[model samples]
Target: MPKRIQSSGRNIVLSVRDFCEREKDNNAPLIPFGNVRQRVAAKTGISEKTLNKAPTLSSTKAEMQNWIINKGLSYLPTMVKAQLYKIIKEHKEAPIYEADQMLQAHCHKVARLPPYHCELNAIEFMWSLVKRRVANKNVGQETNNIVNLAEEAFQSITAEDWQKQCEHVRHIEDKLRERDVYMDAEMDRFIIELNNESDTESDSSSEDSSDSDYSSLAIHMDHAYSK
Candidate 1:
């Protein structure tokens, strides 16, 4: 295993020896993510066309607010969240996780989870199982007793148990996909009904206006899938 590096130059090839090892894969040049070397900058000659613009980086909090107002945006908090963050985030390169960088140094690529979404994780379901087992079997609240119970609880959940949970999630996903087909047909029907009669809101809505539950249902797939 390669010695894991802790930080920057996680992305950099500082020396010729590193380049030789890296170049063995292919002749693709190391594209540095940070400031270019003076020699490199001179050769490349900064072009007018840039990848992304960082308009808000240097601005104070007050200046960001002013920019929001000048743009005739909505509520302060909402504008900051919906609009301002996009401007700042789009300009930035995503930071590599320290643990991920360390692992990559050892030639093991990590499979990253989608940020903030865990409904698809079978391990989450397995965790609940383990927790429930521990709760049921609790003999004492002592540290070692709890630790032993937790270990046994984890061991009780086999590979097959995990596979079952994965299949459960898959079934839910299949159902949602079928649900999407229904929603798509409904949306098309809605559009057709809206302009079938008149341009005005009253005429558009009143045309074949039967109660539609799509609005009332408000079926959040994320919430449903978690259950």
Candidate 2:
């Protein structure tokens, strides 16, 4: 958490560690911070000593190395378990959501967007519209005026616009899901074709080796007869 202090009439600098200490001094509820190892151990009921022994398992490189050492298993169940524990720990100890819950009485259901899919959030489009309006207003006279203009831009977005954006997001979600299904089907087909090709190649190689062996045997018999 960074503390923003007004140095001279709106010119502010952020001090992260100092701000946290200052907030602590002010009796602000300190954010809950959990260690990765401890969190994973608690979630999975795995002993901390075991986790410490495989500390590198928390990392992708270490997971990949473990996979290689295990002879290239398609699925490393242990690695998956470790990753799940890490994910659970991260979600449980998220600073913002945890703080929000502590400060607010109302139950918050946080719906997170998929990674790199900001377009799915209608608020993103609404903000773009608001920023465009603010830029057009050219409220550069004062910071206060700029703030007012931005607020005005935000207020200008109608409920209809919000509804439309929601509808668009729904449509995009359906399309994305459809695309995922198509991709999964294509992947399955590809794997089947690959396996068939490999089997065919193996059969061809076996036939070639058998023919070579037969030819060698026939030549040896002819030599014996000639002798």
Candidate 3:
């Protein structure tokens, strides 16, 4: 729900704030400047100072907020973010040149980034699929046989299977786009309802609130093979 605007002289912050307000859904997380800093510190394990020096991403608070609100949300878990803070803070006392190097190493280990990418994410989907297909029975008692089973499975995927998978991805992408549009429209409708209810407080209004709750992509992503 957060967006980045060029850090405008006076108007930039306000525009960002206003956009957030207009578009915020009932369940949207708050995206204040202070909250963003705290979240970043929690995610990177680096001191705010060290995070400031991060080059892969811009350091501006709005940019950070936008990145997290959009891209990072799927990758970084709350627990992981806290651990990142610990790793960076502990390593910050090292000499300047060494500090960056140490922090970078720690970051790769700490940052979960995207939980899934193109459905290939090991934890998100593929691992479970493999387990479901093969885990119940041992491939073999010995290591070599297990490796052979894995290689055989990898080689089993055929052209027809790949075509079906591509079609499935396209269908998923279309559904996701529809869901986003529905959620956005729902937010606007909810706000309008809220305004109407407030204005008609003295009168007994019986209209049912419109149900705009379309399932979000997060739920789709989180819901893989359930244990």
Candidate 4:
């Protein structure tokens, strides 16, 4: 069983490092930074001269170009191509589990909720109730007693309460899906309207140009007749 630890910055980093170590021991293909840099250089066909002039990892591509210029080096096509390749590679490799083989190793699947959607987690609701109960209780001064009270608060939430929270989350998911569908339809309509407006404006401009041309021709004919 995983130990229930406080979510401090150092603790979180330690936990991630431990998880990574375990995954590494299991023969997970975790690419190192040096390997990534070498791969980026090889795949991009960027020369060492341009790559050497690049700024720190935190700097943007444009900023890196500026840095290169500051170092009396031009940001050539090779550097720009390398930057693009780096961005594409980073985006493509963003997934935590890259291989389908990794998923086969685990018996039970982990359901990862979308980012910023904490309401979908039944544990969040359970924690809220537990914290409220703990706040109401007068477990004072003793560390062991406070721990006991906190434990008791957690124990108060039943399986039925978890089921209800799950149902609530399903309802929220349905509503969100409905809203997304509506927004997509609205976006399609808006794009069509914009295209129609553009076409109409183009036609009006062409008609105006044609009328101007005709007026100019009439003036030229009049000048010729008078002469």
Candidate 5:
């Protein structure tokens, strides 16, 4: 009806026929994408919950076909199915958080510690020291005594105390690194021995290799605490 209407395209008058001809080559798909329908209102059925409704992983290899069936997708070739899976499981970076912006506004930087590493946290050790001091002084359990003792406990901490806690964390890290090195060496040695045994057995058909050739290491790292 508005075949002669102007101003929408800034000089190109509206033409529904021309628009349909240009878009016929492209079907309306991937509702997340496609054109802006009316320049403002996005089309419906474009939500995350709808897009991510893929099949769950199963013990068998039927999940791929299940995904196709659930999505009403046509039977795809192996290569195309693989590409679809890759797109479905693509690694998406997390959304930018407001915490970063708030920190920048106050001229403060954000320092994130590794997850599940309380021993590596300096503040955790400091809290332990303060709690011990407060427990020793607040024997009467009075409210004011507890508060005063806590304040004194926190004030008693010095630079030397913080340095010791940081040093302790470094020591733990060093021990972990040494243990990793030892484990890697043991694994390499075991693999080499197993391969040699297999080769010897193959060379001499009359004699079978003993199970002891693949036994656990006799000389292991000291385990006084029994792991």
Candidate 6:
């Protein structure tokens, strides 16, 4: 994990090493999620606390929102998530203010969506779908072959199939929105009560949009393969 970006809300550190070890225990298979995690964290250290703080598989939709949107994702408040991410990955030291300004612009341009309304950005499901579709199909062992395989995978699906997938995803999203509305209402009431007691002007913030939720969703997969 990069110490530079670790802060109140924006850090979601992934443990590629543990992910690799877990995959090793299973039969070796093509797992892109674990591979990406390993690639991202190769030079940087993995912090146990950051990874462990992630909600477990059984977490409810409301809990997931509280952890991911309200607390976990640093997209809010700070603003410059993309630049900060670049600094961590590229090992370039830059002003957080620049990143902050960039993020503020993004937030300004986009309307916030409820947490549960964005099933299209659920990366874990996408990884499973991709791996199942591409398993055992060799695009050769060369780099170009790998690139070709990715292109083929995207091109293989029909427009109708894509529409069906998006529709199904949207159905789940509707359910999520209902849950979020109920939860958000309760939270808002609590905040109002607190403010009434304190009698101070509370600062307002926006929720993350559905389209932008892609970057925050975490997917874990095994990456051990014959190399």
Per-candidate count of clashing residue pairs (backbone under 3 Å): 0, 0, 5, 0, 0, 4
Instruction: Give per-residue CA lDDT, model 5, range 25-96, as digits (tens).
Output: 566432233445431222232333334445433312366655555555645456455555654454322434
Off by over 4 Å in 1: 1-92, 105-109, 112-117, 139-144, 192-227
Question: Taking the tens digit of each residue's C-alpha lDDT, what string does model 1 give over 169-222?
Answer: 788778878999987875555322233333333634642453442233333232
Q: How would you order the candidates by TM-score, starting with the best?
A: 5, 2, 1, 4, 3, 6
Q: Hey, what RMSD does candidate 5 come out at?
A: 15.9
Quick one: best TM-score, which candidate? Answer: 5
Error of 4 at 22 (Å): 18
**Which pairs, if any, clash in model 3?**
42-81, 45-84, 45-85, 45-88, 75-113
- Best by the lDDT measure: 5
Better model by lDDT: candidate 4 vs candidate 5: 5
Give the worst 10-residue stretch by lDDT in candidate 5.
Answer: 38-47
lDDT-superior candidate, 1 or 6: 1
Worst 10 residues of 6 by lDDT: 191-200
Local distance difference test values of all predictions, in order: 0.59, 0.59, 0.48, 0.60, 0.61, 0.50
Q: Which ten residues in a row have the lowest lDDT in candidate 3?
A: 211-220
Which wins on TM-score, candidate 4 or candidate 6?
4
**Off by more than 4 A, model 6:** 1-118, 122-132, 139-144, 184-227
RMSD for all candidates, in order, please.
Answer: 16.0, 16.7, 22.5, 17.7, 15.9, 23.6
Show where candidate 4 strays beyond 4 Å.
1-106, 139-145, 189-227
Least accurate stretch of 10 residues (summed lDDT) in model 2? 216-225
Q: How many residue-pair clashes does candidate 2 contain?
A: 0
What's the distance in Å from true for residue 143, model 5?
4.7
